[model samples]
Target chain A: MNKPLAAIAAFAGLVFLGSGAWMLAGHFRAQDAVLVEIVQDGKVLYTVDLASEEDRSIRIEGADSWNLVTVRGGEIFMEEAGCPDQTCVKMGVLRAENLPIVCLPNKLVIRFADSQEVS
Target chain B: MKLTTRRLTELALLTAAALIIFVIELRIPDLVPIPGVKLGLANIITVYAVFRYKPEETALIVLCRILLGSMFAGRPSAILYSAAGAALCLIGMLAVRRFIPPKWIWLCSVLGAIFHNTGQILAAMVLMKTAVIVSYIPVLLFTGCIAGAFTGLCAQMLVARIDRKPPA
Candidate 1:
C-alpha cells in the first residue's frame, strides 16, 4: 500500500474504534431522574418526569402544522408531525443527555432541564 | 459530455448497485432517535464515484441516486436534507481529490463528511430560523468521522479490486 494511503487507513481505524468506545460508554452510563420540558417562544408548554410518567400522548400546533408528541413511562418523543420532514418524529425518543427532542418547524424543544434536578 | 454506450451502461449498473445497498441498509433498525444519523451505506458508491469519475459526472450519478433512492424509500421530504448534504459532500471531495492521492482516499471521505454535516446544519438553521439547533453540530461531527472512515475504507478496498482488473 502507498504510504499516504496507509497513514489514512490507520487514522480511520483510530477514529472508528474511538467513536465505538465513546458510544459504548454512553450506552452503559446510568440513567438519571431527569425532568424534560418542551418549551416554545419563551413559554413552558409541557413538562414531565422521565422516570415516573406513564405512556401518554399530546399534540402541539404550529402556525402551519401540528405535531403529535408521545410520553411513554417518562421518556418523551415525537410520534408524528405534519411538517414536511417528520425528522423529529422519526427520531423516536429523547434518551441521551445532549440529544433533545426537537421539532424545527415548530421551534419546540423537549430536553432534559437542569432545573428539574432539584424538584 | 458525450455519453458512450459503455459509459452509460457502467453508470446504470452503478446506480442499480447503489439502490440495492440503500434498500438493504433501510432494513437495519435505527438505534437512535436522531433523524440524520445512519450507517450511510449508500456512501460507499459515492466514495467510489469521487475517485473513479469526473467531478460533474460523479455529481450527476449522486443526484440521480439520491433522488431515486429517496423515492424508493418513500421519504420525499428527506430529499432536501439529502440534496444539501450530497451537494456539499461532492464539492468537498472533488476539491480534495486534487490534493489527496488515491492512497489518502479516506481523508477525502472524512472531509466530505464534515462538509455534509455543515450543509445539513445550514439547512436546519434556515428551516428552523434559530441557532439553538447548532447544539447538534458536535455530535454530528463526531459521528461523521466514524461514518466517513468506514465508507472511505470500503472505497479503498473497491479501488484496489478495480485496479487489479485489466481495462476492457
Candidate 2:
C-alpha cells in the first residue's frame, strides 16, 4: 500500500523479469554452441568439437566418485554417474550456453564452452 | 526470551511441519537437474514463523528444520547450502519486517527468497571456487520469485486466519 515499498517491489519484480527473459533468449539463441567442455573440479578435462569429434564417452573421476559423460552427434550429456543423486544424468544434455549439466557430488560439469573459451 | 510452554510447543510444531514438507518434497522427483533449484515448499513455515513469533524463535525453528531435515535425509553436504540460504532468508525477512506490514507480506517473501538464492550462490562459489556457477543465479532468481510468492501467500493466509494466542 505504501509508495516506497510498492516502488521497491515493482523494481525487484522488473529486474527478475528482465533477467529471466534475457537468460532465456540467450539460451535459445546459442544454437551455435558447438564446442563442448567437460570440466571437473574447475578444470577442463576435455574439450570436444561436436561436429568433428567422433562419438565417445569420457569417464570423469572425482574424489571417490565417477561420472560418465557422453558426446554424440553435436551434443553432450551425462550418461550416468556413481553419485547417489543422479541430478546430472537427468539433466538430459548440454544445450544452452549458460545452462550446464552438473554433478555436484562428483564435482563434474558439461557445458557449452565456445571454441575460444575452451582451454 | 523466556521459553514458555506455549512457545516451545509452537516452535516444535513449526519445525515438525517444515521437516515433513521437506521430506515429502524429496519424493516429488527433481523438476529440473540443475543443482540448488527446488520448490522449497517448507519455506512457508519459515515465512510464517518469522512474522508470528519472536526473531530468536524463528531462527531456532529454521535451524532445527535445516539440521534435522538433512540428518533424516542423510545428506550432510546439503546442510551447508540449506543453512546458508535459510540464514540469509531469515535475516532478510526479519530486517524487512519493520517496513512491510502484514498486508504486504508477499513482497517480504519475495525479498527473502532473493536473498536465500543469493546465499546459496555464494556458498557454491566459495566451495567450488569457480565463477561459472554464477550463471545459475538468474534462473534461481526467477524461480525463487514464483515459489516465494506462493509460499508467502500461504503464510499470509494462515496468519490472517489463525490467532497467535488462542483463547485459553
Candidate 3:
C-alpha cells in the first residue's frame, strides 16, 4: 500500500474500531435518566420524561406542518411527519444515549436530558 | 460534445443496472433506523464506472442515476443527501484514481465512502440547524467502511474479469 492509501486505511480502521467500542459500551452500561423538552420558536411545546413516559402519542403542529410523536415503553420517536424527507419518522425511535430524534424542517429535537436539572 | 452511440448505450445499461440494484436494496428490510445505515448496492455501478469510464462520464452517469432513482422511489427529499454524498464520493474516487493501482481499488472506494458520509453529515447539520447530529457521525463512518469495502471488492473482481476478455 502507498502512503496515502495506508493513511486512509488506518483512519477508516480507527473509525470502525472506535464506534464499535462506543456501541458496546452503550449496550452494557446503564444510561442516566433525562428529561426531553421540545421547543418550537422559543416556546416549550412539549416535555417528555425519559424514564417514566408511557406508551402514548402526541402531535405537534407548526404554521403549515405537523409531526406525530409516539412514545412506546418509555422510548420516544417520530411516527410520522409532514416533511418531505420523513427522515425523523424513518428513524423509528430514540434509544441510544448518543442518538437524538431530529426533524430538520421543523427544527425539532427530542433528546435525553438530565433529570436532576429540574430540581 | 457528442458521445458515441456505443458509449451512450453502455451508459444506459449501467444506469439501468444501478437502478435495479437500488430498488432491490430498498426491498430488503432496514437493519438500522438511524436514517443512513445502508448497503448502498447502487455503488457497484459507481465502482464499475471508476474503472471503465472517464471521470466526467462516470460523474454524469451517477448524477443521472441518483436523480432519476430518487424520483422513481418517490423520495424527492433524498435527492439532497444522495446528491451531496455522490458528488463527494465521485470526486474523491476520481482524484485517487491516479495514485491507486487497480489492485487497490478498494482503497479508493473506502476514501469515497468516508467523503460521502462527511458530505451527508454536513448537509444534515445545515438542514437540522444543529450540531447535535454530529454524534451520529461515528456510526456512519463505521458503516461506510463496511459498505465501501464490500462494493470495492466487488468492483475489483468485475474489473479483473472484464480486463481478461478481449474487446468484443
**TM-score for each of the candidates:** 0.74, 0.91, 0.85
Measured against the true two-chain complex, the DockQ scores of the candidates, in the order shown, are 0.24, 0.57, 0.46
* Number of the candidate with higher lDDT, 1 or 3: 3
- Candidate maximizing DockQ: 2
User: What interface RMSD do all candidates show, one decimal each?
Assistant: 4.7, 1.7, 3.1
Taking the tens digit of each residue's C-alpha lDDT, what string does model 1 give over B20-125? 9999988877655475777688888888887887676778788889999888877665677788988998997886575677667777798788778778878766
Indicate whether candidate 1 or candidate 2 has the larger DockQ.
2
Query: Looking at candidate 2, what is the lDDT of residue B67?
Result: 91
Please give the distance, in angstroms, between residue A81's alpha carbon in candidate 3 and its true position after superposition. Answer: 4.9
| Model no. 3, DockQ | 0.46
lDDT on C-alpha atoms for all candidate structures? 0.75, 0.81, 0.77
Q: A51-85, model 2: which lDDT tens digit per residue? A: 78888998878785798888888778889888666
Give candidate 2 misplaced runs (Cα > 4 Å).
A114-119, B165-168
lDDT of 1 by residue, A1-119 (tens): 66655654575466556655666665666767468877764457877876777788888887756888888766788889886556688777787655676775576777776565645
Please compute and give the TM-score of the first chain of candidate 3 against the native first chain: 0.68
Clashing pairs in 1: A5-B103, A55-A73, A91-B33
Error of 1 at B93 (Å): 0.6
* Docking outcome class, model 3: acceptable
- Highest lDDT against the true fold, candidate: 2
